[model samples]
Target: MSDPYGPPPSDPQEPQGTPYGNQPYGQQPSGQQPYGTQPYNQQPYGQQPPGQPPYQQPYGGSGPSNPDERTWGGAAHWSALIGAFVALAFLGPLLVMLVKGNQSAYVRAQAVESLNFQLSILIYGIVSFVLAFVLIGFLLLPIVGLIWLVFTIIGSVKASNGELYRYPLTIRMVS
Candidate 1:
C-alpha cells in the first residue's frame, strides 16, 4: 500500500482511469463515488439522465405495427367465390359482409360482387325456365335446365379461381 503508482489513489474504492480522479473515501464504486466521478451534467441514479430519452424500440423494427396489415391481408383479395357459395345456401353471410365487412373496402366489394353473381344466376334460371315452358312446353324444359346447370357450374368454378364473369341478361343489383 505504498505510493508505487504515484500517490497511490486518494480513494481505495475507485479503479484506475476514473477521469473524475480518486473516488470518495470509504465509499466503494458499488456503494457510492465522489461527486467528480460522474460524467458532467449526469443525473442521479433512477432518474432520467441528461440529453437522452429512455430506450424504446426503433420506429419500424418490431411489435404490433399496421392495423390494416393485421386485420386484412394485403389488398384483402381473397376468393369471392367463398361468399358466393355461402350466399347460395344462406343470404345472411353476404349481408353480414356488406355491413360489417366494409371495415375493409376490398372485402366489401368482393362480397357485393359475390351476391350479384348468385342473383344473376337465379334470375337467368327463372326467366329461361318461364320462356321455355311458354314456347316449347315440356320439350325444352330438360334442354334449358341442362344449359342452366352447365353455366352455373362453370361460373362457380371460374369465380372460385378468382375470375370475374358477367352472365348475360342478369339484373344489376350492385354497382
Candidate 2:
C-alpha cells in the first residue's frame, strides 16, 4: 500500500505509541503516573497498600484469610428445615451434610444431626403412610410431622447459637 502519511520516521528516539498499533503515541502530562502504576510506590485499589509503621499495633492479630471461616456452620444444621419444606423430604440436609460435613465441626455435627433426623422422619413417614390404611396412620402422621417440625426448629436455633443439639428421636443412622 502507498504511504498515506509519507515514509516512517527516521529517528530511533521517536515515541511510537502502542508500538505495534497504528495509533499515534504521545507523552503523558507532567506529574501523572502511567496506567497500571500508582503515584510513587503506592499499591492499586483493593491491594494492602504499604503504610508507615504504626505507633501501636491493632488488638487481636488476624490470621491468614481462611475460606473455611466464611462458611456458615449453622446452615448445615438448618438444611433439614430447608429440605423438608423445599425438597419435600430429604435432599436438602443430604446435600448440605455430604458437601460441608468435613469442613467444620459445627457443620459436621449439625449436618449429621439434621441428616439423621431426616432419615428418621423418612422412615416414620413411610410407617405412617402404611398405618393410614388402618386409620392409625392418619393420626400418627400429624404426630410424626409435629415432632419433626418442633425438633427441626430447636436444632436450627441451637446450631445458630453454636450450641450442639441432638434431635431426641433422631436414629443416628449415618452417625
Candidate 3:
C-alpha cells in the first residue's frame, strides 16, 4: 500500500516534463524577455513612463491642494457667523484657525483674517455699547453689525473660491 503522506503517483500516459510544467526554472515563456532586464518602454525613476501623462502637483504645493482644504478655508471665514450668534464673534474663527491653521497656509491666512476682523468688530461693539449712555452707541452698534455681516460674507465667498481674502479694516493683531 502507498503511504498516505507520500506524493501521488504520476500517470504513465502523461509525458515527462519539468517540475514547473514544460518550462524549466528561471526561464520565461516564449516571446517574453528574461528576468532582471528592464522593459523596452520603461522609464527611469522620477520620470513619466512612456505613453503616460506627466503628474501635476496640486496648487504648486503651496495653496490648497484639494477640495477639503478649500472648504476649510471658507469655513474659517463662515465660522464667525456662528460665534456672532453667541456674542463671541471671534470664537468661531479662532477655533478654526487653531485646528486647521497648521495644515494649510490658505486656511491659516483666511482664519487669521476672519479672526482679526471679528476681534475688531468686538471692540467696536463694546465701544458702541458704552456709548449707548450718550444715545449714539445705539446707532453705532447697528453699523458695526452691518459691517461685520458684509465683510464676513465677502471673505467666505473669496475663500470658497480658493482665493486668499484680507478683511478691510482688520487690525492684524494675531498676524
Candidate 4:
C-alpha cells in the first residue's frame, strides 16, 4: 500500500547525491581544498585537510608544540648539585635531584627521575661509608667502610648515565 507523506520509499539502488552521502563523519567533502575554500565558519564536522594554510592545527606549517622549549635544563639542573668542588659536593647534586625530581615537568622528566634515583644511591653509599668509619673509630668493622666506598664509586659511575638504584635504610625526607 502507498502513503501520502511524499513519494513512496525509493529502491535500495537509489543514489544519495547529498554532500554527506559518501563522506564519513568528522571529515571534509572530497575534491575540495582544505583551506581558503570555505569561510571560517563551522567546517564539515570541523575537519582540516592535509597541507592546509594558517598552520593552526598541530604538526603543520608552523610545526608541533614544544613542551620544554628543547633545553638541556634537566642535565644542568642535576649537574649543579652533583658536580661540586669539594669531596662532599657530589652529594649536593644527588640529593637535589632526588628531592626535586618529582617537581620536574619537562620533556626530560624521565631523565630527571632516573638521575634522582641514581643520586639517591650515591648519597646512601657515602653515608654508609661514613657510618662504617665511625664504627671503626670505636674499634669495629673498618673493612665494611672500605667495601661501602668501593660500591659507592661504582654506583656513582652508573648513576652518571642515569640509572635507578635504591639504597637500604635510606630516608626519603622530601618529594
lDDT of 3 by residue, 142-171 (tens): 999899999999999988988877788778
Each prediction's TM-score versus the true structure? 0.34, 0.56, 0.63, 0.27
Compared to the true structure, candidate 4 yields what TM-score? 0.27
How far does residue 23 in candidate 3 sit from its true spot (Å)?
92
Query: Residue pairs in steric clash, candidate 4?
Result: 81-93, 82-93
Clashing pairs in 1: none
Compared to the true structure, candidate 1 yields what TM-score? 0.34
The global Cα lDDT (0 to 1) of model 4 is 0.43
Question: With candidate 2 superimposed using the best TM-score fit, by how many Å does residue 149's alpha carbon deviate from the native?
Answer: 0.7
Point to the candidate with the largest lDDT: 3
What total of clashing residue pairs does each candidate reach?
A: 0, 0, 0, 2
Error of 4 at 165 (Å): 1.1
Q: Rate the local accuracy (lDDT) of all candidates.
A: 0.47, 0.66, 0.83, 0.43
Local accuracy of candidate 4 as per-residue lDDT tens digits, 1-175: 6888877776777554545466776566654556556655546655666577643321112211242312232342344345444534334445444554444433134234334544554565555567666674333234434544454454444444443333343334332
Off by over 4 Å in 2: 1-71
- CA RMSD per model (angstroms): 22.1, 14.9, 16.3, 14.3
For model 2, residues 44-143, the per-residue Cα lDDT tens digits are 6755645845333221223212335223445665666776666465666667767865555556566767778888998999999999999999999999
Q: Compute the lDDT of residue 101 as modeled in candidate 4.
A: 40
TM-score, structure 2 vs. true:
0.56
